[model samples]
Target: MKKCISFLTVCLLMAKLTTAQIIPSFEFGVKGGMNLSRFSHTATFATENRAGYLGGIYARAGGLGFNFQPELYITSKSVTVNSGSTQNKATFTSIDLPLLLGTKIGAFGVGGRFYTGPLVSFAINKDQNVGDALGNALHLNYKDQNLAWTFGAGLDLKKVSIDFRYEYGLTKQPYNNGNDETRINLFNLTLGYRLFSL
Candidate 1:
């Protein structure tokens, strides 16, 4: 009985050591996707699906089956409204920062990412029916980054990876329409590539 107990203890220790020896593979990649969005309070207006794109470098570090990935990129979002013969549109160009937490099961993977930790925008430009059309050198305010979240799944095929993520905004656009507050909610599908092998 004593010998059996000693053998079991050694086996347990070996398992722990094996787990500790596992290391994560780090890689770089790019991501792009589509955006479908609308104001939360503006139900009278139909939601618009726009072609939003995000392409930038990303670094992933992880061990076992968990990874933390952060990325920087440019994002374009827009909303359109049609009231009979008139058409109205709102477009926003902002730099986006996404921090993703990824998990792997065998060769398949899943992730949850949240963007909006912090950002500085120059507004770049704005086109509104109620305001002036093009003489505006609108600068984006740097008060805070827009809050957003995303969920997606992908496959880590050796050194290459492709992912699809949906992003949703959690704050207003700092502009008000009379008694109505304009908020940002985007549904995005992003595809990314891993550059370096881990």
Candidate 2:
């Protein structure tokens, strides 16, 4: 009887450990990447896309199948604008906050993830130079706060992650004294590594 009881108790403990291994958990990481961004509007000035850099930290909850992630990053966005014969750049430096929900599929330390979320951005530099021609013509005024929706897919191999995402602006910044507005769009690619798991 003692032998049988000991065997059953060990089996139960092993089962509990197996269950914990399959359950979702928490992780935190850091990421950095580049972004290609452009402005969208009906303005007469021609706009061109520009590349910029971003770096940040992210925390994720849940794993195995589903996860919720929140990230904070600093990003630089820019566009080159041409007004007839003159050309200049308009750049914005901002802090970004993104909240995302994602699903993961795969096994054996490798997986693919798809996520979508909302992002809020606060501009660190409110003044933008559009050149004398475009600035005088549009009387551009930039807003301090902006919002967007982002969607992305990623690949995870062990502790490394790579993601590609698109951000579509939902709010417009007014120019010409609130009479005209424009939105910003971006494509982002990032590489991240897990710092730890809990």
Stretches of candidate 2 above 4 Å error? 1-22, 126-144, 174-180
Residue 4 lDDT in candidate 1: 100
What TM-score, to 2 decimals, does candidate 1 have? 0.64
Candidate 2: the clashing residue pairs are: none
> How many angstroms is residue 191 displaced in model 1 relative to the true structure, after the best TM-score fit?
2.5
Which candidate wins on TM-score? 2
Candidate 2 per-residue lDDT over residues 19-77, each given as its tens digit? 44368778899999999988785658678889998898988886445789888788888
Q: Show pairs that collide, candidate 1.
A: 24-62, 28-195, 29-193, 30-192, 32-190, 33-189, 121-140, 122-139, 122-140, 123-140
Q: CA shift at 44, candidate 1, in angstroms? A: 4.3
- TM-score per candidate: 0.64, 0.76
Position 170, candidate 1: lDDT: 58
